[model samples]
Target: MAEGGEDPQRLKKIAAAAYDYDNDSRWTDYWSNILIPPHMASHAEVVEHYKRKFYQRYMDPDLVVEPMSSTSSSQSARPSASTTNANEQQARSRSSGSVPRTAGPSATTGAANPSSVRWDQQTIQFSVNAWVFVIAVLAVLPLVPKNLSNRAYRLSFMGTACSSLYSLYALYGRPRAWNMQGMQVYFQSIVGAKDFIYFIYCLTFVTSNLCLKFALIPILCRALEQVAKFLRRNFTRSTIYRKYLEDPCVWVESNTTTLNILSSQAEIAIGFLLIISLLSWQRNFIQTFMYWQLLKLMYQAPVTAGYHQSNWSKIGRTVNPMIQRYAPFLNTPVTAVQRWWFR
Candidate 1:
């Protein structure tokens, strides 16, 4: 103790704190390794300045509003006592270039993540939108006139593709769900969010091109009925997926018994029209297109089955490189461009 029970060591630390505040060189180094919080055990003034400023900029103000009094008609003209005191203190600290020795819990708690919570809400809504879209397409497709069903189906496919792509982009760019990693593994990643049933439903859109044979349409509907059952069982209970699957209007339910016959008939008619368009020369194009669609499905099947992107990449590495070499030339749009030049 130096004098009157004052500790000599604390005086030295207080001096060091002043030294730290004035010296820009040490302060720069202090910030370069900023992740390591300052040694405030000695009541570092330099650290305190920053800590107060941090709260001023980022802290949510704890406003205390008392019940209004009818006697005070000029209430709006005067600020609250707390606010006035806070402002006065803030001004004094700024003028003196010294922060008060207040290291309250609010200063250390940092900021709350309102944006993160909002994004989670957005992700839930996006999933709900996708679910609603597919259901709408299914319910309305049976009623669509045969003459316009082709265009209507194509529009439905395009709409779904856009929605899927948007969801994927949004999901990948930022993480929202606590258990989920990225959209690449969203539906299938058991280690992440096990939402595989939605992935299967998305695939059915791509496969609708193969909607041939009216008699087998009933069987396909039956299989999708099972898909609905599986989705309800596996996904409806989980917190992340329940918002999408179990929501009142968005809940995916179809009368498989009644709908199957109508759905099958629609498919038969669609198949007949498609078959009538297959000219002799177009047979090769049809075959090639089918092969292309199958190839695409092969690439996606593993992902749909729940493997992560890393695993799928490794699994396809052998064949993918070879296919890549010739894919550009064989691709339909590229070939069409080459043909147009000669014609």
Candidate 2:
């Protein structure tokens, strides 16, 4: 009814549509277009929370917002908090938290949505598959006879070695963008003999090519040294810095982004604790477990979460046929070996 205050229903309409992390509503765009604040925005904190959601979800930090023509109510609309605790905590975040920076239009081509649960989960899955494949290859290589004349032997060796190196880098995590200061911060966070043990565990399998009586001593010491160095790096810090928390395009959890980083670390630990051989009963067991896990994880990718999108039908149509075709190829070797040995 007034000069600038818009109808509550109009404000509700603008806010009701789900925000897509990839194609989002802009911070200033909201300021310009949606003049009516939602009735549920009870206080300044609620308004601040809404501001955080918009700026982080849509706008880039460097792109400054052009000044909007002021209206009767300047604050943006806010959604109702789902519960009392969230509302109270939000108040705290408003008071203590440094809200994410807002930019208007010329920020970098909108960066990747770093905090989207779906995005992070997908990335984690990819990283897991990558390193797991490498680990499997490395585990299987030791089983085959070491005959230089056998072309398969040489190819598998070289391939396994290269994959091993890449796995080390994957364990190292994001090295290029992470700096020395961050590394140092991470190092400082390491506490106790368990951390030292975990680091040593990583070293044992890394140097599996060596088969000396005391080889483990040097490897253990070196593992400790490298992990000590790794601890110093800040790239592993867990919490989203308060100032940067508002930016939806930025990562919230340092470790959770790609792969079950802790599990990957633990995988190296298990590799060190026991020697893996394809002939052993353990191999069959573990292989069976891995296959099930891979299939389960693969299927999960297509399951849409609340705000996440996926094309499960399309994915299944493509992968299902490939699985059926390859199933016999994988089983043929075991079947042949069984018949030959028994007969």
User: Number of the top candidate by lDDT?
Assistant: 1
How many clashes does each candidate structure show, in the order listed?
0, 16
For each candidate, give its TM-score against the true structure. 0.28, 0.23
Q: Write the per-residue lDDT of candidate 2 for residues 1-343, one digit (tens) a residue.
A: 1126666444433443333433432334333332333553454544554554444323222122222223323344222222322343333233223342333243241122222533454344344333433433433455545442233323333333343344332322222225898556433322122223323333433434332222233222222232322332322363642244323212212322122332333333333333344455434444334433332333233211111113334444765577568775655665564455234
| Poorly placed runs, candidate 2 (over 4 Å) | 1-128, 134-138, 141-143, 147-184, 190-200, 208-343
Model 2 lDDT on a 0 to 1 scale: 0.35
Per-residue lDDT tens digits for candidate 1, residues 1-343, read 1346676445644543344334333234223433322332233443454433332222211112122243332355244433433444444344323453342356232123333543564455455445544544553467766646555444444444454444343332222243545333333322121122233333444455443323233223433443454455456668766765554323334354344444434433433344454663333345334433432333344322222233335634854565568675445664574355234
Give model 1's TM-score versus the native structure: 0.28
How far off is residue 183 in model 1, in Å?
A: 18
TM-score of 2: 0.23
